[model samples]
Target chain A: DAGVTQSPTHLIKTRGQQVTLRCSPISGHKSVSWYQQVLGQGPQFIFQYYEKEERGRGNFPDRFSARQFPNYSSELNVNALLLGDSALYLCASSLRHRGETQYFGPGTRLLVL
Target chain B: DQQVKQNSPSLSVQEGRISILNCDYTNSMFDYFLWYKKYPAEGPTFLISISSIKDKNEDGRFTVFLNKSAKHLSLHIVPSQPGDSAVYFCAAPDTSGTYKYIFGTGTRLKVLA
Candidate 1:
């Protein structure tokens, strides 16, 4: 089976613009989560959705939001982008909401000028 | 605050030697820990995991050791190979119901042939 997949592998946005990244969980997976990875740094948790319900959120600001669809796909939305938002946005999926191994996607690279 | 930390920014090891990467976490609430490997332009892939109930877990050439008293964890790759060279991340799940992961800053490992 294919691993988790993400869309628009690369994106460019202005400081005040908004961007949306999409992710499709591996088949049969029920939980999806979002993370932001800055250069030379590990990924930071953003949000997690399980069974299409908001199950977890990270320390990110209100401008970052996400949702999961019935099919277990997810979308991460960032508003009023800042230069600091220029990083790889990764999406992960797992079989359950807790204590399960998560597989990740190639990630969406967002650059804000 | 950085609850999880990989103080080593990078590591270089001979191909036939063992590669050891360390991580320290501050949150006592974290009960599960995981390791992930990532290549350039790709998302992280699961390496190994250990629960609070266990002190050590091994898979193939990889081994992870957990020291609950010191809040420290380390990944060991025996007979390291060039393919094993990549950024390694250590993560732990939220104690609450979020099911989210807190990640370390990552250590870039370079295995020399």
Candidate 2:
């Protein structure tokens, strides 16, 4: 089966601009999560959606938000981007089963200039 | 605050030797732990996982040990190969049912042949 897929493998945005990144979950996965990884650092949780509902949120600022579609595809939006927002935005999908593992997508690398 | 930490930013080991990567977590509420491996320009892939109920979980050449009392965990790869050169991240899930993951800063491993 195909793994999770993300769009716009790379993106360039300027400060004060808004950016949107997309992700499609594996064919049969239901739970999807988003993460941001800065250079030389681990990924930080952004948001999680299950059954197209916002299930959880991280410590992100109000400018960061996300939503999942009925098809289990997700989009991450960042408003008023700052240079520090430059990072790799990763999407991960997992089954709801106990002890289930989350599989990741290739990610969309956003560079804010 | 960084709840998870991997103090060693990088490690070098000879091929065919054992490679040990350490992780320490500060939150006692985290019950599920996972390890992921990542290469440049790609997203992280699940390597293995160990629940708080278990002390160790093994899969092929990969083994993860969890010490709840010490709030520490480590990943061991036996007979490390050049192909194993990559970054490893340690992650923990929220026990409050959010399923949010907190990740370590990651450790880059280089296997020399």
Candidate 3:
């Protein structure tokens, strides 16, 4: 089966702009999570959605938000983007909300100027 | 405070040798730990995982050793191949009882032929 898939493999945005990234979980997966990875750093949690409900959120600012659809796809939106927002946005899916292994997508690389 | 830490920024090992990567965590609430491997432009892939109840778990050529008393874990790759050269990250579920995961800074391993 195909693994987790993400859209718009790359993007370029300007400061104060808004961007949206998309992700589709593996078939039969119900939980989706988002993470941001800055250069030279590990992936940091952003948001997690299980059964289409917000199950957890990271320390990111209000400018970052995400939502999951009934089909278990997810979208990550960043408003008023800043240069600091430039990074790789990764999406992961798991069988359930807790204690399960998460499979990741190729990620969308965003650059903010 | 950083909950997970991978002290070594990079490592270089000769092919057919053993490559060891270390990680440390400050949170005792993490009941399980996982390792991920990432290529340059791809998302991290689930590697190996071990529960706190066990001290070691081994895969084909990869072994994960956990030391609960030390709040530490290590990933060992035997007969390291050039394909194994990539960034390795150690992660654990958040202590907040959520699905979020905390990841280390990652250690880049380069296996030379």
Candidate 4:
């Protein structure tokens, strides 16, 4: 089966602009989560949605938000982007909300000027 | 605070030798840990995972060892291959019982032929 898939493999935005990245979970998966990875650092949790509900959120600012659809797809939106927001945004899916392995997508690389 | 940490920024090993990557976590409440491998421009792929109840878990040429008292974990790849060269990250679930994960800074491993 196809793994988790993300859209707009690459993006470029300016400071104060807004951007949206999309992700589709694996078939039969109900949980989706978003993460951000800067150069030389590991992925940082951003938001997690299970069955279309916000299950958890990370320490990111209000500029970052995400939501899951009934089909288990998710979108990550960043408003008023800053240069510090430039990074790879990753999406992962799991079969359940807890104690399950999460499969990841190729991620969308975003650059903010 | 960085709940998960991989102090070693990189490692080099000869092919057929063993590659060991270490990780340390601050929260004792974290009972499950996972290892992931990532190539440039791609999302992380799950490698292995271990529960706090177990000290060691092995799969194929990969092994994960957990030390609860030390709050440390390590991933061992026996007879490392060149394809194993990549950034490896160790992660643990959020302490808040959400599906979110806390990932380490990652250790880049290069297996030379």
Q: What is candidate 1's TM-score against the reference?
A: 0.96
Clash counts for the predictions, in order: 0, 0, 0, 0
Residue A82, model 1: Cα distance from true site in angstroms? 1.8
What is the C-alpha lDDT profile of model 4 across A1-113, one tens digit per residue?
99999999999999999999999999999999999999999999899999899999888999999999888999999999999999999999999988789999999999999
List where candidate 4 sits over 4 angstroms from the true fold.
none
Pairs of residues clashing in candidate 3: none
Q: What lDDT is reached at residue A4 by model 1?
A: 96
lDDT of each: 0.94, 0.93, 0.95, 0.95
Per-candidate TM-score, chain A: 0.98, 0.96, 0.99, 0.99
lDDT of 2 by residue, A1-113 (tens): 89999999999999999999999999989989999999889998899998989988888999999999999899999999999999999999998523468899999999999
lDDT of 4 at A75: 94
lDDT of 3 by residue, B1-111 (tens): 899999999999999999999999999989999999999999999999999999999999999999999999999999899999999999998868687888999999999
Better of 2 and 4 by DockQ: 4
Which pairs of residues have clashing backbones in candidate 2? none
Predicted structure 3: lDDT: 0.95
Which regions in candidate 3 have their CA more than 4 angstroms from the true location? none
Q: Tell me, what's the RMSD of every candidate?
A: 1.1, 1.3, 0.7, 0.8
- For residues B1-113, what per-residue lDDT tens digits would candidate 4 score against the true structure? 99999999999999999999999999999989999999999999999999999999999999999999999999999989999999999999976767689899999999999
